[model samples]
Target: MKRIVIIGGGPAGYEAALVAAQLRADVTVIEADGAGGACVLSDCVPSKTFIASSEVVTGYRDTEEFGIHSDGLEAVTVDATAVHERVKRLALAQSADVHSKLVKAGVTFVAGTARLGEDTLGHTHRVVVSPHGSDSEYAIEASIVLIATGATPRVLASAVPDGERVLTWRQVYDLPELPQRLIVIGSGVTGAEFASAYLAMGVPVTLVSSRDRVMPHEDPDAATAIEQVFRARGMTILNNSRAEAVTRVGDGVEVRLSDGRTVTGSHALIAVGSVPNTDGLGLTEYGVTVADSGFVPVDRVSRTNVPGIYAAGDCTGVLPLASVAAMQGRIAMWHALGEAVVPLRLRTVAANVFTDPELATVGVSQNEVDDGRVPARQVMLPLAGNARAKMADLHDGFVKLFCRPASGQIIGGVVVAPRASELIMPITVAVENHMTVSQLAHTITIYPSLSGSIAEAARQLMWHDEE
Candidate 1:
């Protein structure tokens, strides 16, 4: 039986353990953090839970839009402490659940940090597990090793998180009270998400964007729509401005911009980005090529340069989504264990930004088309034209489709709407399966649905093909 040791209990490590166990490999997972890693324990699950609460707060504010009248609407309030408590409970519960699943799968779960080293003969790889807060260490011989240590939130030296007045994305959920004025620096997905969530909860939010627009990496149209919504809803956005330094000033925080301006708020969130948690793993000694940014370099199959060693998750410099991490883990196991495997095709991956009227996209994008990287024709259908969107009073988003001009094959799509994460699935499927616009247009969709807009976009693409 093949012995496999996986470092880090994040989505990638745990998922690979399960797959390796199913393949009858003797699997052991060494995780310094609890099971489920940061995704469940702190970052993704916790932030999304907070967003879910904010969505409820938004729903209460929109009660009148649904033709429902309630005298107590004015009395509705959000309890920040209670909301945070719920987020913590849900995160912990999920971590425990992942632990249970790993145990049930018969994968050995060790609560420790792991470093790669050579065996006695220097012919095979071995793992040294060092339990947290302990000086003792033990070594395990492995035929295969998977590294999925994940990442940590990037913090600028000029702007350090005090975990009080200033916070990182991971530190926000533990706050006892919501900030009256929340200033989020960095208009990437993390910054935008927290800003939008806080705004929905009735907090005054100021979003600082170093770029010209929020979510500069996203579809331009989608970013514009979100920015419009933010401005209309009373959220302040400072574009083309970079934060120079953050300082605490009399129970409040002051963010000095590069332009010699200062913005003060009750609390500040530094959402600049993340750095891979790849340090101190002894990877360099073992011939693993780590980038200057500490990210491990891997092939499409998640293999490292050294034989029998693979890397996945954020440490591998792949897409940072938990789904992508999990898939990379599975792919690593299959490829290393002599099983048939498919290399990751990032184009078919769906990514979502969980803001109000969530933005989700799959496959190629408009920028790619504009840059001439993808030879595709595109069409966009407004959600306002959909019956369900009208009923829901969602006038802010659109469904855009991209297809090959000659064959009409669906290449990519973007959906900006409430629950856009769910709505982008069909587009992802179409892109993955190489479905054509005509085929998508022919599919039956329920009346008065957001999905109707997707179909309509495809039909429009079909017409464009004809023309």
Candidate 2:
């Protein structure tokens, strides 16, 4: 059997390990953190779990339309401690499940740090591992090596996280209680999600954005819709404001902006971005080229510049979504083991921002179509027009579809609504399969469903103005 050694136990790394084992290769995974890596332990799982709790409370808003009133109950309140209890519980359980799967798949799981280089015996195709909780080290010889070490949240020198008043996205769960007024710096996906979650849970929030709008990287219309909701629900959005420093003052924290202004809050969350966890991995020594930004650049097959060295997940600087990372991992294994491989199609990748009214998209974006990148006919239908949306008393968000003018082939789509993440799947499938708008329109969706808006948009897509 061809031997494969994978570094990191994240979705990318563990997924690769499972694929390698299925291919009948001897596989080993070395991870210093838990089996689920930072994604499950701190980043994706915990945050989403916390958001799920917040979303429940968000539904309580405007319930009077459904004959529900606050007079029936004392008040709807969130217990930060209880929410975090569930967060940590689910996170740990997920880690354990991933660990069990790796073991069941016959992949050796090693709790240690891995360095790519010659072993003690001077074997160039060997990895030196410093086992966790032990002083001794060992070496493993593998015919192929994969690096899925993921990334770490980037920390600013001027604004350090105290794990209390001032915190990073990863440090927020450890907070004993909710902040009186939470200030979220950076209006990207992470910042927007946290701000929306907290606001929905009745926590006063201030969003500090360096850009002119929240989620500048996302669709403009989508961002505008979210900003409107945030404002309507009493969120203080400071667009075009850059945080220069975040320092604790008394029991709270203060953010000093670039323009000599300060915003104070009980806690400050720095959601700027993250850097690839490439240090101490000896990537360069093993002939793997890393980018200046510390990311390991890889192609669609997840192969680095050097043969037999594949990188995936956040470390590759591809899309930072967890689903994309898992796909990259499977592609890497298939290519490495000589299986019939289909290259990763980035265009069909679905991305979602988990907020109050989630924003989900796939394929081409509005910017691309408007900028003459992807010429297509488009239609956008408001959720207010949907029967189910009216039943739920939901008025925000829309379903948009884009199709080629000549052939009516669906090229892209966007869904802005509650459970938009789930609603985008059909469009993602339509785009992935190169289905035409007619094909999608002919399909039946439930009468009282938000997803029916997708079908409605598809029916009207080909007749709309071409970009």
Candidate 3:
């Protein structure tokens, strides 16, 4: 029987364990953190759960738009303690769930950090597992070794996370109370999401973005819409400003910008990005090629340059998303087990920023089309015209689709609205399955639905093609 040792228990490691076990391999997963790694235990699950609470607060604040009386009602207030408790509870529950799934799939779980052992270059490799807070270690022999150790929030000496006044994304939950004001120093997905989330929770937020706009990687129009929404909600956004350092003030924090200005807030969140957890992994010692950026260099099949070894997830730096990590892990196992496997295709992968009025996208981007790299026709339908969006008071989003100019094949799409994550799926399906604009346009959609805007966009594209 093939023996597979996976290091890390995030989406990549756990998902791969299930697959390898199903293939009748003896699978062992070594996880230094909880069963679901930082993603479920500290990062993705906890953060999203906290964000969901903030969304509920936002919904209550918007109740007046639906003619619901806010007068003579108990004022809604956030209990940071309660919110953090629930967040941690749900995260632990999910971690337990992940562990149960792996066990049911006949995969062994090792609670420890793992590294490549000597003779790792051989056909069969050795994995050294060192349990936390222990000097004792053990070795597991494996025909295939998969590294998915993931990454950590990047910390700068000038802006260290004190877990109270100054914070990293991970330390936000540790805060005892809501800050009088929050200064988020990074406008990428992490920074923007937190800024939006805190603002929704009735916290004054100042987003310090080094770039010209928030979410520079997202669809430009979507970014503009969200940024506008942020400004409208009284959130201050300082663009083209880099934070040089963050220092403690009197019971608050002060951020020093490179432009010789200072901004003060009760708390500061450093969302500068993440660093891959690649050090001390013994990858280079075993002859596996790792980039200077600390990410493992992998082919589409998730294989490293060295045979009998593979890497996946954030450690590979393909895309910093849980879904992408899971897919990469599954692909690694399939390829390792000698089963028919398709190489990872990132183009069809859907991504979402979990902010209020979430932005989601898939496949070809409008930037590529505008730059003439992709010859595609584009159509956009404003949600304001959609009956459901109007009923729901959603006037700030649109559905945009792109199709091949000649073939009318759906190539890409973007949806910006409440739960855009859910609405982007149909477009993702069309793009992944190579469905045409006509096919998607003709698909019946329920009336008075935000998703109907997607069908409308497709219809407009088809009409243009017909003309």
Clashing pairs in 2: none
Each prediction's Cα lDDT score?
0.93, 0.90, 0.93
- lDDT, candidate 2, 312-338, per-residue tens: 999999999899999899999999999
User: Cα lDDT of model 1 overall?
Assistant: 0.93
Which sections of candidate 1 miss by over 4 Å? 71-74, 119-123
| TM-scores of the models, in the order given | 0.98, 0.97, 0.98
lDDT of 3: 0.93
Which runs of model 3 end up more than 4 angstroms from their true locations?
Answer: 72-74, 120-122
Q: What is the RMSD, in Å, between candidate 2 and the native fold over all Cα?
A: 1.9
Q: Which ten residues in a row have the lowest lDDT in candidate 2?
A: 117-126
Clashes of each: 0, 0, 0
List, residue by residue over 1-467, the lDDT tens digit for candidate 1.
99999999999999999999999999999998799998889899999999999998787666677778754335668899999999999999999999999999999999989898754465457889998788999888998999999999999999999999899999987788899899999999999999999999889999999999999999999999999999999999999999999999998999999999999999999999899999899999877888998999899999998888999999987899999999999999999899999999999999999999899999998899999988999988889888998898888999999999899999999999999999999999999999999999999999978999999899888888778
Per residue, candidate 3 scores C-alpha lDDT tens digits across 27-58 of 99999888999999989999889899998888
Clashing pairs in 1: none
Question: Against the correct fold, how does model 1 do in TM-score?
Answer: 0.98
